[model samples]
Each structure stands twice: as structure tokens, then as C-alpha cells.
Target: PEHFLITLALPAETEVVWVEDFYRGIGDCLDMFGGFLAGGETSGVPSGSAAVISIAATGSVQREHLILRSTARAGDALFVTGTLGGSIHGKHLDFTPRVEAAGWLVRNFKPSAMMDLSDGLGKDLPRLAKASGCGFSIDETAIPVTTGSTVAEAIGDGEDFELLFCLEESRADGLLQAWPFADLPLTRIGRMEEDGKEQALGGGWEHFRS
Candidate 1:
């Protein structure tokens, strides 16, 4: 990654200290993710409305390492990193990107397709299946649900920010046995099918819809 760019529309009553604190947090993230504080624009929004913050990044990836969601294959084993759901209980704003885990997996394993779980598994999984021209079968019991979340929430509650990926079923065992992160929980949630009978499920966080 090269730089981080953030654009903001703040309310009139917004405090300057809060902005500094936010930038400081971003700086901390940069230290972990490798990026610079490239400049951005800020403007005032009408009071009593809502404050908006938009972030964007510019980076370059090698053709081989640039994982794409549309490349998932039928019969591939689907996997996800860490527990899901319950982001509303403070994780939405306080979560780490799976940079280290993803980097290691991409370097050592051949994931057929990979993507971050931003729109909940129920939603994003179907999109991935559609793009790859496959149908997915999710094992609800296998989902690593958070402490206070249900299986449905784990599938539908958005903003998980974990890695959802797929690979050949043959490699699933080796990847699990060779996983190095003890604290991080990686689970094989389901598989892709050539004749997709399972329909696409529901999801959360429709930015413009709700």
C-alpha cells in the first residue's frame, strides 16, 4: 500500500480535539499496515444532520498475489478467519484487519479465491458464488459465532472484517495443520457446488438501502 486518504464532512459542533484523536488512530493503523498520511479534503455539513467520513487507499499488487473473489471454483472448501457477528458490541470500530494471516496464507497456500468479510457471510458469500458461477453450501453449525452472537447473526451481521477465502478441498487439511496463529481461529465454514441448489441468503449493512 502507498498512502491513506480520508475525506470527512463534520458537523458544526464537532471538536477539533476529536479530529486529532481520529488522525492519531489512523496513524497507529498506518504503523501496522504500512502507509503514509496522504492529504485529503474536509468540509462542514449542516448541523443536526449527520457526520460522514469516507476513506480510500491506493496500492499496487502483483498479478499473481492479487486475489480475486470471482475465481472461486466449484468443490472448493470455504474458510473464514476468526469468529463472526456481534460487531455492534464494539468490534465495528475496534477490530484489526487480518493482514498478517492473509499474507501468510497467500505466501504459503494456494487459495482459489479470497476476500474480506465486510458485508456479512450471508451476503458476501453469495456474491462471491455468483461471480465465480458456483453455488455455496454453508454449514451453519461450523460457523465460529462470537460469544453473544447467533449463527444467523454471524451470517448476516455485517462488518466482520475477517478473511473469507476458498481453496481446493485437497489442501484444507494441510492449511489447518500448518496454521501458526494460536489465538486466531480459522474455520472451514462450507463448500462451493457446481450445481448450486442453495439460494443466496440475507445480509446486513446495505449502505444506501438502510
Candidate 2:
């Protein structure tokens, strides 16, 4: 619920209709996100097997408001919202998404590319660069490392759930100055380099490795 909220910036009052197997505190979790359990299914699994739950959601937005990662271009400045790393220490489950910040950005400046940092900056940044047909040069020192998190962890610790985006370099300062989320920390991390030769970073969660 929280992840989708930040991803889409849907209204808090919006309800999430879903279906799922029975689980303790399920209703409570939905309530926390201002969602109501519209309908669901319940069943018992084999005694020793783990139960699985699946949820589906829907939201609406005007066509003009859509943003995509492929729009990034050379000379665009990269920025990240909120701290990174050590998400395993409660940040992943508790941190709020940058929905409001993203809205403000779209309203004030046109971002060339945008995405959430779920699979770690190291892994995700390359994907964004590829989609945009550009390379990226990031300043390690400018990355916002969370307390108790090393720079490496900030690069690789998956589930940070912050926003990473690129915008025109000329508008970077004005956007930063007009940013409305006083509580959310925003940092300029890098720029889009030339296409075809990407400077990639190491570390990130891999679902499968030998």
C-alpha cells in the first residue's frame, strides 16, 4: 500500500480493493495506509507449508501527468530524494515514499527520467541509464548515506524506496530551492553522461547467483 502510494501519488483517501488469504493483522495494515479491505478469499494451506497472499490495486491519473525513464537525455542532472542504505534496519518497512516530492518535481520542472530505488542504486541506476540511452556519472560523496550505513551499503542495500530522477542541469538549483518537502532530504548525485559508455557501480540484491 505504501509503496504504491508513493509510486502513483494517489490520494490517501483512495481505497485499495484486494483479495488475499487469511492473515493476522491484515486489516490493520490496510488501515494504516488509509485503505479498506474491499474483498478477499481465505483458505488453509498444507500444515507445513507457508501461506501466500496476493494483492491487486488500481488508480487513475491523467495522461499528461505520466513520466517515464526513457525520457532522460545528456546534460540532465541526477538527483535522489531521502537517505539511502541500511533499510534492513527498519527503514524499508517504515520509510514513506516520495510521492509528494515527485508531484512537486513534475509540476515545477520536467524530469528527464524517474524511478524508485528498490533494488539498490548500484543495480537500478544502470537500468535507468540504459533505458534513457545515456551513461551516468555519480558523485559517491553526494549520496545520502543513512546513519549506520556505509557508502557501499547505500549503493547496494535494496529497499531504500526513495526516488531517483534526472532533470535539466540548468533547472537544478531552482528546483531544489522551490522543493516543498522540508522534511525530505534531496541531493544532487550525478549527471547523465554520453551514451554507449556507462560508468557502472557495484553491489545490489540479486535474486539468483551461483
Best by lDDT: 1
- Model 1, span 110-165: residue lDDT tens: 59999999989988888888888889898888999999988878888889999999
Give me the displacement of residue 145 in model 1, in angstroms.
0.2
Error of 1 at 39 (Å): 1.5
TM-score for every candidate vs. truth?
Answer: 0.95, 0.80
TM-score of 1: 0.95
Off by over 4 Å in 2: 1-40
Model 1 weakest lDDT span, ten residues long:
195-204
* Per-residue lDDT of candidate 2, residues 74-185 (tens digit): 8899999989999768779776667667777777786878999989999999989999889999999999999999999999988988999999999999888888788889
How much is the lDDT of residue 128 in candidate 2?
Answer: 92
Kindly provide the TM-score of model 2 when superposed on the true structure, using C-alpha atoms: 0.80
lDDT of 1 at 55: 90
| Number of backbone-clashing residue pairs for each candidate, in the order shown | 0, 0
Would you list the C-alpha lDDT of every candidate in the order shown?
Answer: 0.88, 0.78
lDDT of 2 at 199: 74
**Number of backbone clashes in candidate 2:** 0
Per TM-score, the best of the predicted structures is 1
